[model samples]
Target chain A: MIGRLNHVAIAVPDLDEGIRLYRDVLGAHVSEPQDEPDHGVRVVFVELPNTKIELLYPLGENSPIRSFLEKNTAGGIHHVCYEVEDILAARDRLIAQGARILGTGEPKNGAHGKPVLFLHPKDFNGTLVELEQI
Target chain B: MIGRLNHVAIAVPDLDEGIRLYRDVLGAHVSEPQDEPDHGVRVVFVELPNTKIELLYPLGENSPIRSFLEKNTAGGIHHVCYEVEDILAARDRLIAQGARILGTGEPKNGAHGKPVLFLHPKDFNGTLVELEQI
Candidate 1:
């Protein structure tokens, strides 16, 4: 089962502009961009009181969010990650309930170095959901 | 300045189905549907630990999110509401920074009976942002 709302990831076309918007305009404490080559994206954390807003930018040509950025050139919310206690149990339960797991149904190391699994958007009311094991 | 993320509103085509998915499948504590005619939408709140996930459905003929539900069919993230200490001050500061406020540029009574203002998505990295005065 989902534990906590981890972070909402927004794929931005321009990373600096996104940072400036959140930092200068929104007046939020923002972290410097960290490159995650394994995840194929650059991420900045906008730390709020209760949760985080992750600003995501494509790192390379093969970045997974590249197409999403292309479609929404100004940037848009890409997905929301929820913290889970036991990922494999959660995955199995979701699978038993006829939910579809994306990307070979295997847990991948997320940007936070935690095991994560993505559920199919269609099964989740068109919202792409990521489950991060905490 | 923004404080906690109040809730992320997801516009769903079917409110009942959305409730089932979150409550039955994802296993979150979902509230009963509450109709807000003033806001032109009915909402169900999924109470997570830190924040809430609001599932929205069109209420009547002039429902604001009717077109969005039609476009997304399955459902999609409509907007994210962030809490602010003083909304008028926040609005004025956002305007000074060249951020466009949606609608008549005045705070309206949001579904939760709080004064809320919506910023133009184009001005905010294509993410619809709502600022509710806490």
Candidate 2:
């Protein structure tokens, strides 16, 4: 049911600064950033050899990214995304097993246009879990 | 500078229950558990084809895992560790760049006896980052 790791989600205070650090300093290459209006965040994808790094910044007060930044406890790791063979089926299984789904029923296009969904951290312990279907 | 993902660490209250869920239900294979008295926790490793899952339970009050579970906030993900070429060099680079180190300067034996060190989450943001040298 699980594929290779697709990407690692990271929450940062400043998208530009994060991009600079990951790209210029860390030597990671990123694709042009895209914004998700519905999710209320602008994100960039720093594609790595085996996995990708996603940098997220809030676009509005209602955005969860904003809340995440406000907490500002650590700007480090946000979520681990496992590539899945079937996202819809996986989401259903998780829901049936009592995992709370964060987004609407539909999976939306994420940083790289891949369909993605988030499992509520409350349900999965403290770690925010994201599932991306390849 | 890195190998395939080694394992993902998770903190849970009941080591037995967590083991059952990941092993019996998730169909992951696990190695016999070992106890780390110094770290104050007992741990089990569930080995997957592409990755490994670590289940940690506190053995003493001083264990960080114990405090993590006491929060009872979630029964989910803990930290994401990336395989690295040189953990010592990586540690020094992160330190020089202002990242805090969690363990003593020496690399300790982790679940599989691999050398590993944790970068303070406060320094890297909220994410608990671990680097394991292959």
Point to the candidate with the largest TM-score.
1
Candidate 1 C-alpha lDDT tens digits along B27-130:
99999999989889999999999999999999989999999888888888998989999999999999999999999999998888899999999988999999
Top candidate by lDDT: 1
Per-prediction RMSD in angstroms?
Answer: 0.7, 3.2
What are the runs in model 1 whose C-alpha is more than 4 Å off?
none
lDDT of 2 by residue, B1-134 (tens): 43445667888777777776555533357677779887787889866546666878888778877666766545556677777788888777766666677868678886557888886765554667677888
List candidate 2 stretches off by more than 4 Å.
A20-33, B1-5, B20-33, B46-49
Q: Report how closely model 1 matches the true complex, as a DockQ value.
A: 0.87
lDDT by residue (tens digit), candidate 2, A8-119: 6788887777776566534457777788877787889876556666888787778777766766644756777777778889878776666688858678786557898887
Q: List iRMS for all predictions.
A: 0.7, 3.4
10 residues in a row with least lDDT, candidate 1 chain B: B67-76
Per-residue C-alpha lDDT of model 1 across residues A18-120, encoded as one tens digit per residue: 9999999999999999999998999999999999999999998899999998888899999999999999999999999999999899899989999999999
